[model samples]
Target: MKVVIIFNHPYEGSYCNAILKSTLLGLQIANHQVDVIHLDKENFNPVMRSEDLRAFINKNPIDEKVIEFGDRLKDAEHLIFIFPIWWELMPALMKGFIDKVIFPGVAYDYVNASNTKMKPLWDKVKGITVITTMNTPSILYNWIFGNAIQKALLRGTFWKLGYKNRKWISLNRVKMVSPEKRKKWLTNIESNFSKLK
Candidate 1:
């Protein structure tokens, strides 16, 4: 399968980076072709400008970066997102990617004449895996925050786009954990992802 991994983290040595590396290793073990998008490293502009809004509203391509990312999404069969939860939500860059790349004409199209219903365009995509890390406990993140990231991505985005096999893996209390525990998490991520079809 062709897998596209979107990584959002400013620090190269951060735990999120380790998770991304482990995920790549696992995908390689599965013999899956992988394409990685490092948002920060690419200096991706998270802000949606006036021209971007115009293009989006007009159902035209937003920009070159968005077009490139959209093309990658179009070709991929699996999508993986790795990032750290900041302030109980995803970083602005990732959110911006969603806003910019998943445009009207690219990710979906209106189904009804009234435009009340819609259909997914990227029918090639089968599964989506979101890996997130946070300093809060898992229960608190889920119960208190209502798993905002998962809701936004899975329910609000992919589910609406006809993706069903969506999985969310949250590594909670990351800062409070020991190095050994972190290592174990990496191993677990690799083992689990290696089994992905």
Candidate 2:
């Protein structure tokens, strides 16, 4: 299986980076072909300019990076997203990736004349996994923020795209957790992904 990880987070020593490393190790153990799209390292342009909008209207992408990412996604079987939840939402670059890369033609297309229904174009992608770290507790984030990531990223985007196997693994209150607890979480992540189907 080809597993593509869309990773974001600027800090190298951050817990998000650690989770990414653990995920890579697990995927390697499972002998999955892994690709990491490091948004911050690539310095991906999140802003959709005038040309981008025009290309979008025509179902075309002008940016070479977006084109390349779309090409890679064509063969992906499992998609993973790794990042830190800031302000109870994903980072701007991650949001931009969705805005640009997951375009109408690239990710989905209308299923009817009214354009009210959408069908996913990703024939090979079977599942999506989102791994996130945050300072807020999971319960509070859900209760206060209304689990925006779930509603927006998973349910709003991928579910609407026709992918059913969507999963979210959130490690909350990272700053309050001890180093040992964090290590345990990493171990669990590695173990679970190693056995991922």
Candidate 3:
């Protein structure tokens, strides 16, 4: 499967980086073609201007980088989101990346679609996986936010676009964990990638 990994962490030495590296290496070992997209490196902007808001009805993504990213999404069979949780959602950059890129017409179509009102844009992709890290405890997030990030990204975005067999693989409580536990968490995600292959 062609897998695209979208990441947004800014620090190279972060535990988030470790998880991403492990995920890629594992996918390589599994012989899956992989592409790594660091949204921060791409200097992705999340904030929308008045023009964008005004053109909301068209939902056309005009940014060049977002266009490139959209092309990759169109071509890939699997998508893996790798990032850290901030306030129970993705970082601002990640959110912006999605905003500027996954436009309504580009990611989905409303005109001449199966639903007439709804169109699935990513039926081309067969699967999705979200590898996320959180500082809060697992139970707290699920209970409070009701897994808000997962439900919003996985069910709201990918599932709406026709992705299947999705997995929200989370490594929780990193801010309070020891180095050894962090390493173990990374290794577990690597193992997951190995299984994906």
Candidate 4:
């Protein structure tokens, strides 16, 4: 299977990187072909320009490497997102990736004036997994903010894009976790990554 990991972190020592490494190693050990799209290293701009918006609305397109990568996302059999949840939301760079790359006519299609068809891309991508870190506890965040970010990615985007099997691994209260626990979490991530199709 071809697995794509979308690594969305600026630094190398963060939990996001740990997750990426563990997951990639696991996939390789399981004999799966793995590829990575490192957001920060790719120098992807998260900002949406006024001109870009006009191009989008007019059916023209932006000429960024990230957008091209988004086109690549359609070819995966399994998709993974490795990032951090900051302030109960997705990181700014990941958010930008979604905003700038996952555009109309790519992830999905809504065409015609009267005749309408909702077509989903990534139909072959049967699995999606989110490996995320959060400083707040799940209980506290759920009570205060709920799972908006998870829902947006899983139920909203992945489901709409026709990904059937999805899993979300959120390491909550990451700032308070011990090193041993973090290591254990990474181990478990390796196990889970091996199970994805």
Candidate 5:
């Protein structure tokens, strides 16, 4: 399987980076071809300019990086997103990647005459897994905050794009969690990914 991991973290010592490392180890053990899109290292621009909006309206992308990312994801068998939740939402660069790379001509297309209905274009993509870390407690994030990440990414974006096998692995209260618990999470993540086929 060709797995694509979209990783977003500015600091090298961040927990998200640790998650990326564990995920890579797992994919390697599984012998899957993996591609990591390190948004912070690449300095991906999350802000959409007027030109980008215009291109989107035309169903075309002018940014070379966006086009390149789209091409990389064109034949992906599985997509894994690793990031931290800031203010109960995804980081800016990850959001920007979605806004720019996961566009109409790249991820899906409208099938109806009114352009209201969409069908996915990435036929090889079987599933999407999102791993998020946050300082907030999981219960609060889910009950009070409404699991915005899942609703926005899984339901709003991927499900609407025609892919339904979506999963979210949310590690909450990272700052408050015990070191042993964090280590356990990393080990489990690595083991689970290694089991992927």
Candidate 6:
């Protein structure tokens, strides 16, 4: 499988980084080809400029970065997103990636003669998995916050793009978890990813 892992975190030593490493290890053990996009390290611009919006509207190439990211996404069969849930949402960088890269011609196409319908272009993509960590309790985040990331990504984006097999793994109360528990979580992530085929 060709997997593209999008990682959004500023610190290299954070638990999110550990999760990324574990995920890579598991994918490697399964002999899957993997590519990683580290938004912070790449200094990805999260702000969408007016020119970008205009180009997108005109069906023109937005920029080189978006084109490159879109190419990676185009080639991948599986997509994995690793990030921390901040205030019930993903960071601005990840959101910007979605806005800029998953544009009209890339991820979906407007159905001709229909303003409300779109046909998904990423038909080669089999599945999408989102791994998120939060400082809040799982139940509270799910019930109170309505699992914002899951709903937004799975329902709003992936499903709208025509992908059906999606999984969301949320690690809650991350700040309160002990080192041992964190390690165990890493093991679980590795085990889960290793089974992907």
* Candidate topping lDDT: 2
What TM-score, to 2 decimals, does candidate 1 have? 0.95
lDDT of 4 by residue, 14-106 (tens): 878888889987898789988898888887778888987886775546656745786777788888888988778887888887776666655
Give the candidates in order of lDDT, highest first.
2, 5, 1, 6, 3, 4
Question: On residues 60-136, what C-alpha lDDT tens digit does candidate 2 reach at each position?
Answer: 88988888898888899999999999999999999999999988788778899888888877779988999999999
Candidate 1 error regions (>4 Å): none
Native-referenced Cα lDDT, model 1: 0.88
Model 5 misplaced stretches (Cα beyond 4 Å) = none
Query: lDDT tens digits, residues 29-60, model 5?
Result: 99999999999877677888999989887889
Q: Candidate 4, which ten residues in sequence have the lowest lDDT sum?
A: 110-119
Q: Residue-wise lDDT of candidate 3 within 20-74, one digit each (tens)?
A: 8888878988999888888889766778777666555666766667668877777
Query: Candidate 6 — which residues are off by over 4 angstroms?
Result: none
Task: Show how many residue pairs clash in every candidate, following the order shown.
Answer: 0, 0, 1, 0, 0, 0
Better of 2 and 5 by lDDT: 2
Give all TM-scores, in the order shown.
0.95, 0.97, 0.88, 0.90, 0.97, 0.95
lDDT of 1 by residue, 155-186 (tens): 88888877889998889999999999999999
Provide the global lDDT of candidate 6 against the true structure. 0.87
Candidate 6 residue-wise lDDT, 70-143, digit = tens: 77778788999999998999999999988887888877787876546777776677889999988999989989
Computed on alpha carbons, the lDDT of every model, listed in order, comes to 0.88, 0.92, 0.79, 0.78, 0.90, 0.87
Off by over 4 Å in 4: 111-117
lDDT of prediction 2: 0.92
